[model samples]
Target: MDNLTHGLLGLAIGALRRPDGQRAPAPGQGPRLDGPGLRWTSPTDRAVLFGCVLAAELPDLDGFLPAADPVLQALQTHRGLTHALVFAPVWALCATGIARLIYRRARSRPVFSYSLASVLFAHLLTDLWTGWGTRILLPISDQRYSLDWAAVIDPFFTLPLLAGALWALARKRSWRRSLLVGLTIAAAYMGFRVGSREILVRRVERAYPAATRVEVFPALLSALSWRYAAILPEGYSLGRVSIFGPVEPVRTQDLPAELPERAADNPTVAEALVWARVPHVSIQEREGGVLEVRVADLRYNMGGEPTLQFVVLVGPQGETLEARLERGGTIGEVYRRWKDDRRGALPAEGGAG
Candidate 1:
């Protein structure tokens, strides 16, 4: 999920409950974060509201950490250690301490702790719904888990939360009601998507009875449509599934089950093989006899092309010249130059000039 959606969810949560553990005041009779004639009546309320928003957006800070390889960096950063379930309590405590310092109210400690923890866990849960996957059980397990129920950015899912948050910010008396309705709608939408995915999977299985393995991925911008990949005895079957339509494959390709021999020597390719859910390997001969090996994950794609791809350039003698991960764009000149430099450094007997 994006930061805007997370912040809006935090805003709704903060307005629905009071930080001092007291029940929220009746409509038109409480401290409001905004709107005319409203003033800051409770410092604890302000502290808790901001604390929840900060906690909700804090886990993504792991993206700043560094890694030697782009593939490893992607796997270990972004949704890495900070988003782990075991570290939520620690993060919540830190957020609570900060809130206390800012508000100077020791009495709000328990409230801040509870609210912050809730927002942190909510962040992790929302990320898990997207196809990118999240390492919720990090340290204990580096495996990334995902539901594939929603796209990373789903306007349909975020609209309700946005409306509710706007209502709260507008200082409407019935803000709590709006937020509750929004949350309920959002939950229902998720349930519908999950059911749709299950139905689509079953239909595809029936269609391809010979498939050894079948998996469905959430398609971009539509809950009713999905992309699927099936492992058949001969090769792989790739296609799109429409809940209301037929289960016809888009295309079929003969992809190797393992990385190509030329790319196996590259460390980045090895790491990508482990990280990719449905690995698709392709070999192309580039200019000057360079072997361009592309290992892509078909789970995430746009316009029928893999969005997350790892590229490795191999020399004639099978030495790895350049290895890097491409998120969604074409290979840049920097990569070309890097490969040229590596090729230039090779021994005279290794390959042609």
Candidate 2:
């Protein structure tokens, strides 16, 4: 999920708790007027809200590392150890120390540390929804986990949380109530997305009964549309299904995705394979006997937009010469880039993969 959603959820968590470390009473249990509209103007409330903001955004600090290589940065730092479960408490303690320095009163308030820690956990929880995923088991395992239920930047997921957090901030008396409502709505929305995803998965399964595996991703900003891919013995089939539109097959190359033993050892290829769910690997011959190898995820390419791909230059005998990241953009732009990369390597010129 995006940082904005993380921040808003942190604020909601902070606002849901009263300054006295007690949560607002459930509906009908407290004074009817004291519901969400009750404003508690306590210094602790301010401190807690500030602390939440700091904690939620803290996990993203790893993204600031001065790593030069995008792949190295992605594999080593971004959503790496810092976003792991074991590191959340350490992060919380560091955040608490910083908060204590900024807000002297925070040193005496245990609730500040607790709230900050909770918000940090919230940050990790929310990241599960993104396709980029997070490495929660860091030192023990480098496995990345994702729900694939929502896009990293879905307004359907963010808007309710944002609105609720804003409402909590706007109506002092109703802060707690508004926060609860926001969290509830967000949770329910996710449940809906999950249910919808399951249905879509079933639909795809029915459509491609021979598929050995199927994966579905929520379309950008939409719960009604999805991108799905299925692995078949021959190759893979990918397509899009839209509740509002028609379900159709995705454009894909008929090439096999299996990596030849010789090319599998390249770290660049390995990392690209790890990152892509439904990958397509292809070979091209360029001028001067150079071989161009590409490994890309089909899901991102299905939309006809710019998508990440690993392009490697190799010798005729499969010795890797150079490898770098490239992207496929809209049809025209991708055509130009592909054309440029294959200059003087066409089949008429005796170039063969």
Candidate 3:
């Protein structure tokens, strides 16, 4: 999500339902730091900041999942099981519990369950339109859905109104006026998103000429433009250029999935896991096996680099998406430059005791 989006989300939440505004103290002033795991704070302001940042970044927590054997990582950060609806409530509840305990010690009012839920909902909704899909329902079942009505980033969708939101809060405008301004902006975006999707659908149908059964979603984070991906009888492919907006739909292609020479857990597997895109969507064999991982990245070249494709994954039998991980120590000593960098990768299995 954009920083501006995060900031606006935070401010809107604070103004709309903060005790500092008019709402009754729901509970202790609770934890305000961002990110998952335990968090705590003493002051209302800090708590609000916590609420805001958490609301902003909560959708991306699944990016932290470890890769399975024969790793399949994608550059798409938010397209994973972590974005699933089922996982969200559990994560939120756990975080809320931590806040409740911490606020108990500080004797501050814990944030209302309402506020927490509000933020979570906002996070999910914000990501719902982008090209990268989010699986809101996971574990109950692997059901992935999206509107695909916006680009990876959008200027028309958020800029002017988000700017107004900041101005309203900074100048201390009445809550109603500020909220109205924000809502108007949001409403306009929704309208544009619809129109954009319609245009892409028409163009896509023309491209295929005889295509049947199409699915299109605007890439999340994109402003008004959309990224259209569809499944054909042969295979799946992204649509052509936006023709109106800044987006360029990726053309579909058929590629071969080259399995890792050895589909066993190790550092190479970890490398692939980071690229898997989904934090929770990985192979976990009870007695050593493989998984069908689907990876999508525009940069992949099948006959050339073996990566940079729209969908890439591996399985016990064959390839779902053409995917494989090549080793890299570090790039200019910027990342993965040390042993500890691997700490964030999924824990390795089949290690020595």
RMSD vs true structure, all candidates:
8.8, 6.8, 12.3
Task: Compute the lDDT of residue 229 as modeled in candidate 3.
Answer: 44
**1 against 3, candidate with superior lDDT:** 1
Per-residue lDDT of candidate 1, residues 42-69 (tens digit): 6676677677777777777777888765
> What value of lDDT does candidate 2 attain over all alpha carbons?
0.68
TM-score per candidate, chains pooled: 0.79, 0.78, 0.54
Q: What is the lDDT of residue 60 in candidate 1?
A: 77
Candidate 2 clashing pairs, residues 3+ apart or interchain = 36-174, 37-173, 37-174, 38-173, 39-173
**Rank order (by lDDT, best first):** 1, 2, 3
- Top candidate by TM-score: 1
Query: Candidate 2's residue-wise lDDT over 1-353, tens digit each?
Result: 67898887777777666554245546554433355444344446566777777788888899888654565466556888889888887767665667667667554355456555655546887887677788888899988888787888888777888888778668757667888788888889888888888888888888888988888886655668788778787666666786555556654344344566556766656766787777777776689877677877666643422267777766656566776667555769766654542232221111112
How many steric clashes between backbone atoms does each model show?
0, 5, 46
Index of the highest-lDDT prediction: 1
The worst-scoring run of ten residues by lDDT in candidate 2 lies at 344-353
Mind giving the per-residue lDDT tens digits that candidate 3 earns over 116-217?
Answer: 554454566666655444556665654455666555456665675576676755754343356547756766767866786687777777666655545555
Segments of candidate 2 deviating more than 4 angstroms: 21-40, 66-68, 107-121, 242-247, 255-262, 285-291, 303-306, 312-353
Model with the higher lDDT, candidate 1 or 2 = 1
Cα error of candidate 3 at position 268, Å: 12
